[model samples]
Target chain A: MLSVNRINTYRIPFTFEYYRPRTLREALEILRSVEGAKVVAGGTDLVVDMKFRRVEPKALVDVSKLEELRYVRLVEDYVEIGSAVTLQELVESEVVRARLPLLWEAVNSMASWQVRNIATIGGNICNASPAADTAPPLLAYGAKLLLTSLDGVREVGIGEFFVGPKRSIIRPDEVLQAIRVPVHPAGYGWSFRKVSRTSFDIAKISVAVLLKVDGGRIRDPRIALGAVAPTPVRARSTERAIESLSLEEALEVGPRFVEGDIAPIDDVRSTAWYRREVAKVLLRDSLRTAYERSLNPGWVHEG
Target chain B: MRVRLRVNGSWVEVDVEPHETLLNVLRDRLRIRSVKYGCGIGECGSCTVLLNGRPVTSCLVLAAGLDGTSIETADYLAKTELGTRIVNALLLEGAIQCGYCIPGFLVTIYAALKSGMIRRGDSTEIARAISGNICRCTGYINIVKAVRRVVAELVAIGAD
Candidate 1:
């Protein structure tokens, strides 16, 4: 149900100690020391979970205040984005807009501007929601995560990050430090589309695609979908089906293979049957747009 | 925990619980009525407020996490020059109905007008700027008109 129908309680029913550390190191130490501590940056997801008693941690280690964890830069070969960087910041950044248009599209299509002001990429990924809009783009981009703990730092690809609903591979003591997406060549094209009940509603189905057309042949195509499976996933079979075909042929046959990659189920927003049907349309349309954008780089995204 | 906020151009210190949201802190503790609590979740922009010149839902913001931050609510903004212009624009266009969502809308509009979020009077651009605020009344036609007027006025004065 939409939140406008019902009013939530005035305050969080359960209480927890809140720790806002000054530095990334201090935040990690607090996360390691506190029992059942959770990392909170924007609180868009965690606060709601805590309010509904869906998740109750003993303490909260806030990383939003850490200056070191708020950055968006293009390193030698990858886009280095701090985990604590807010979605609005990412949306407004010129570096991200030009370098990762699909990510910008995904973030721009997310929750209202009010929510985007404080929502962080790390929280969106960590929440691990099946309908997370950010997940599909990250998965298509083959993004990587840097999870840090007292022991050391470990990197995990975004495709293997989420295990199930509201669950991830992140350890209790580890904090997601940064997200890195390898910079693709200049000729790569991308597309992102999300169909929600309303303009501001959560996605019922979403699709993201990235590929390059070399001499009429689609190469290195990556396709990802959301709200269709237990986790936002890469459509491996669909990618393989369109590997050597022309964009016109891929548009006709790629969408058919998408059914084999996703396992949809009935939910409040949509049903498995409906999702299975809409998935084909979403893929076909995105493949067409991706093909168009691949041919025209200047018009990757229109204002 | 205790924190200080520069709210509506005034600095005040308030003691708040660790789990207390900014919505509760502003309404229950500080007696700021402009910030409404329509939804405890982030979906409803009824709890919208300007934190550091950016619009954010107060319900999802932890009061304990914000210290020495600047907050601007509709209550204080209604008295400012920009706020007065926005209210007048809405009034001239007859944009208010039951008015439950106006406060949040006003804050969002004021923030958008003050920033470069809406550079032109385009309906789609203005609609995206105010998408956070939900008005049950008036189909947002007059609201968009009001913003368009403000955008034109700002453009004429070279203020934006």
Candidate 2:
């Protein structure tokens, strides 16, 4: 049995250099110079992993104080979210709650209120966990990640950003500055579904769907699933299979198409069979909700 | 690293290692024992504290990152009128069984009531607000009752 004192024993059991850069330039310089420097925005995930010895960087660049990386703007065709914006800020934003209900749902279900207060979207994306709750929604929305460094800035499509589980294409010196999410067109319906061990737990399987309906036929359907693959992936085959179909007809063929898109595996959270079954149900449920919501946008706001 | 922060309304500076968590600094250096350490990971909310007026698990917060922030723990809240009201309600509801989780729950309840996200007698809101906190002893029934009672009292008195 672990002693009581051991509960807080790892609370700084090791030592490493720390840097708090006031400006983005300074942070980038430190990252560029240091061999094993990690940027800590919220430190919610990084700190815990460090305590568990899962990661041990030579230095930590604290960027939570960089005021430049904090804003939420609705531009002409996109919603630009500063990567440092906490999940709590996302939940509190009326624009997010109204204009991007799918993203809002995904963020709201990601973590508890307390954790949400400190966890940032940048950290969530940079962690690149297959079970990341925000990934599917962002993938469905076709978001883009803004990566900045001493060199300059570049934008990577969200789909291309995540390479695999616990890994991404993020350069060692680059910092994710903001997430640019395309605003959904009017008359589009979207839904997000997550199956977790508990209400506040990480997801075993999650799905996000966005589609438009005209004349009782689906159009431009998009589907994304998380935790069932190495990276959150768009269900292209599933979307193609259900295009131009009525809600009833789509539901009939959706589950089979989903099986082709996702590759589930046994894990501590759930069995591969359970994930496949739940993924099918979630796909159907999200499709039904999206279909119903397409008929009435105001219905999306309803409880 | 030399870090400075306002803890419980007092500005203090301490040298903390890069790996040190805010929980370690609070309990070890500042001697704030009310912030209990249940699970070092963020799963358990035993080390919850208010960072810049928002409740967060201090165990997950790096002390080095809190260089210029403000933190409030349960011990700090116990002095306020709202904190006293919550404590009385907890007592009335018999929420504290083993008392291991009381400090964390009290801090969480205080933040919830103060944030205005929850209203009086809304058990659903109360539960949602504190869902991150794990209370093994009481099964959360009495704790929910206690929070509701405090909310009702605050509402009746017109305390915003």
Candidate 3:
């Protein structure tokens, strides 16, 4: 049954010029020429936002058809995923499930299969939502983004990519081309946790943790929290508190240090207080599970 | 803009607006009614269709971006024998209440069965495959049963 709201209709409220570029160079050229042009990969977020009058770009350059940005490959010491690689492709890749399990987990925790079929990793990051499921995992994994423009290409660390909610350092003329995620060494445990209203709903609080445990003591743990601040942020204080401590010891003290890392605000989905409280719980759970996975790399944990 | 794509095995060229979704082009321009519009957003599965042999929400897809792509909707799919069998199985299992979401589920099941991604009678796999679709009448139990029924038939006939 369709719930038709008078205000929110299927019709896109505004008209915009559209371009479907076949190649990366052509797409970049269109971006450079068209003033106030926005790049649409999946349109899972941008289309809905347009219907709601959240963003009204003068034109849209559709890069969904560009073959240059639709791949997932291992190059050198990193796994490079093209920005246009769909979420469904990420979920079906055995390499992603094996090498980057947290990334797989984050993709699984995202929207439903229908949405995943169209949504791309590049679109998720470029959309720059604070609760973008892929951001926390990329942040913890120390991934770098490849941004391309007519002038040249530049790489930006994932941690510094997002400037604010719905904003990133991406220039109007540049497009996110690919994401380079460093391959983890042995004995590294990774876990991603997302708290949402339903399996398909957006996350209220999501956390991803990567830890290396050696001989029962944690080493250089990294924590990333989402939907708790203006942008997905790494919890350095929490990581420092848990570093060099046993799993049990970290669980006791690490959560307390998270308060200094996140600045949550009340929204329609949840309250700031609730987000703050759950952030700690999720951090503890992620840390414990990550430690367990670190001990046994063969362990399989579903998102 | 003039966009050209293959729809249900036929080449289609249409003049469409930049913001026009594939759902509108299919239903309004081509008269392909199997792809229903629901929740206009990506949340509802009523508008599910096969894009390049993969299941996708047609409502979220812009028609202008689908140039040179292949799309399949249930309306054209029902011409095939397997599609007809699946439709019959749904009625046998009493899974067609209200009938709005049936087209999406059928198209998704068709794609999943063709892809060979799920084992026969694996309800968990089947449920996960169709998790994107919403049946507001709460007819999921029977819908799953209907899919299982079709799978059993396909297995009996030794169809891949």
Question: DockQ numbers for every candidate?
Answer: 0.86, 0.72, 0.78
Compute the lDDT of residue A258 as modeled in candidate 3.
96
Measured against the true chain A, the candidates' chain A TM-scores are 0.95, 0.96, 0.97
Q: How big is the positional error of residue B107 in model 3, measured in Å on the Cα after superposition?
A: 1.1
lDDT of 2 by residue, B73-95 (tens): 99889889999999999999999
lDDT per model vs. reference: 0.89, 0.88, 0.89
Residues A111-230, model 1: lDDT tens digits? 899999999998999989989998998998889999999899999999899999888999988999999987655787888998898887889999999989899999999999999999
Give the per-residue lDDT of model 3 (tens digit) for A216-241: 99997989999999999999988888
lDDT of 2: 0.88
Candidate 2 lDDT, A48-88, residue by residue in tens: 77776788888989887788788888998889998899999
Write the candidate numbers in order of decreasing DockQ: 1, 3, 2
Off by over 4 Å in 3: A1-4, A300-303
Q: How well does candidate 1 reproduce the true complex, by DockQ? A: 0.86
Q: In candidate 1, how many Å is residue B27 off?
A: 0.8
